[model samples]
Target: MIRDLEDEILGCTRCSRLIDYIRKVAIEKKPKYRNYQYWGKPLPGFGDPNAWLLIVGLAPAAHGGNRTGRVFTGDMSGERVYRALYEIGLSSSPKSESRYDLVELKGVYLTNAVKCAPPKNKPNKEEIGSCSYFLKKEIESLPKLKVILTLGRIAFDTTTNILGIDGKFSHMAIYSTNRLTVVASYHPSQQNFVSGRLTWGNWISIFYKIKTLYTSHNA
Candidate 1:
């Protein structure tokens, strides 16, 4: 299943023009960056085949997921996320370095709204719209997806739009739509880290809510 998804993504030129432009700029700006080599390749999705929990993150970090082709890998955001997953009994391993390390997810699947790395880590609306098809397909492919943990406003908005939900952002009001529990949280970007906006305890609190919500949904 994963192999097929990768093949489809690699052959996809639906957004080729935009991808090409982004690649050109990334390469020209950071020639030494390894992400430039695989910048054009389709990003990979990870986790259980029947995952009930789906994590929607922003586009892959230029040097992190974009370079490794695995969501949340080789990045600080991933480090904190995986640690929490491990603590919450959602991951088999604490380390999410790469697929080669046998890192596996349990009952949770991870993906991004935009598969490709956007310039400056921000994907414009046009680019997000262009990649919506893939996101739609992924959501459809998962037969047991019941919860979505959106890691920022962009991710929250995009995932909600894809799921056909209509509402404004409310961190306090955890809503249920399309048979999914939508949990919103701030993106664990470097900016959040340096500014001390998302501390370790606060991050864990979000995941704790996810655990409780998911458990309630299943019950």
Candidate 2:
């Protein structure tokens, strides 16, 4: 079922603007990674089928995920995210350079609110609404999912809307309901890192707290 869902997501063209942008990005190519072929297609969820933790981000990076075909891969944000996951022994590697790389995530699933990369890293309201269907379907498919970790305000807002939950976006904020717990965090984007808003010490701390919550839920 997951594989079928992924295939459907890859073929989606719900948002023409996003579809065109990804195609243009694929053809133009980043100067440094010019030799490589870009994925350019809509990204789907990536991780264990029975994952207990769901990590949601705003969207794929044009040069990172759009190029490598994996959310959070081939980007600076991915570096910090994986590094922190590795610190907590949840990731096989500290870097997510490629989807085909042996960087496995244990007990966690990774996905984005918007499957396609939008220009300037921002997706308009219509685009977000169109992608919400896929997000909802993906979440429903995960039977064991117990918690959602949303990175960035957009992701938090999207998740809340899709799940019909009342919440606010704030770094390290936790919200709970009869369904799943939601933990909000600042995105591990370049701006957050450069501004010292999300340092390694604090970034990894988020995972540690999640680990405890995850274990408790499992128990």
The candidate scoring highest on TM-score is 2
lDDT of 2 by residue, 1-219 (tens): 667889999989989999999999999998999998999999997887888889999999999999998878989987888888888887888888887888888878899999999999999999998998988888898888999999999999999888888888999999987868999999999899899998888988999999889888878
User: Compared with the true structure, what per-residue lDDT tens digits does model 1 show for residues 1-219?
Assistant: 544675686666666654675466555545566444544455757888788888888887766776666788878998888888999998887878764677888888898888877767778888889787777777778888888888888888888898778856655346688488888888887778789988888888888888888788878
Candidate 2 yields a Cα-based lDDT of 0.90
Displacement of residue 40 (Cα, Å) in model 1 is 4.2
Clashing pairs in 1: none
Best by lDDT: 2
Task: Quote the RMSD, in angstroms, for model 1.
Answer: 2.6
